[model samples]
Target: MSELIHESVLDIFCKYATLRREEMTLETSLLAAGMDSLDAVEILFALEERFDITIPNPASVTEATVGDVVNLVSKLVAEKEASPSA
Candidate 1:
């Protein structure tokens, strides 16, 4: 599940980043590694739009690893599943 989320994020970034998937470590800091803030925001917005969920904050995701993003998304998905809207 985490891998799927990681792939989704990387796929978006790959379109905007010069870096390839192999070049990114799971723990690599995309922010520190030269990912433009605007692109990051775009990716964040894309994730929420694609996933049909709200992401708390982009800043909170700054320190995230690929796995962390996956975990957060997975947790949110699980929560949504646990409490569906009527």
Candidate 2:
């Protein structure tokens, strides 16, 4: 599940980043990869829609590495799966 989340998040990032998917790594910084503030918001929204989960904080996205976003999405996915409402 985490791997799937990682791939999906990477795919979303690729849509907004100037760098190619092959050039990105878990430690790659989103901003350093050519993502601006608007890209951050768009990525967050994409993640939310793809995973059907809410990101409680938006600030984290701007300064995050690829791994950070992957981990966050994984956690949110797990929470949603565990929730009774879900």
Candidate 3:
């Protein structure tokens, strides 16, 4: 599951930020990868769509690293999966 989430998040970074896969690591900061505020928002939108979840506060995601986003999305995915009403 983490692998899938990682792959998807990497793809989003690649598409929106124009970052190369070789330039990323778990601890790599998105901002350092040339992502600005707008890029973060765009990636958040992509993530929400990809994961089928809603992010109420996109601003908070701007400072996250690749692993952070992966972990966050993974958590959200887990919660949604565990919840019958989600």
Highest TM-score: which candidate?
2
Badly placed stretches (over 4 Å) of model 1 are none
- lDDT by residue (1-86, candidate 3, tens digit) is 99999999999999766568988898988887778888888888999999998766755565789999999899999999999896
Query: Clash totals for all models, in order?
Result: 0, 0, 0
lDDT of 2 by residue, 13-45 (tens): 999999999999999999888999989999889
Tens-place lDDT per residue, model 1, 15-60, is 7666677887777665654576676788778888867778886565
Query: What residue pairs clash in candidate 2, if any at all?
Result: none
- Candidate 2 steric clashes: 0
The per-model lDDT (C-alpha) reads: 0.71, 0.90, 0.86
Query: For each candidate, what TM-score against the reference?
Result: 0.78, 0.94, 0.90
Q: How accurate is candidate 2 locally (lDDT)?
A: 0.90
Q: Candidate 2 regions off by >4 Å?
A: none
Model 3: how far residue 49 lies from native, Å: 0.6
User: Which has the better TM-score: candidate 2, or candidate 3?
Assistant: 2
Q: What is the lDDT of candidate 1?
A: 0.71
lDDT of 2 at 32: 82
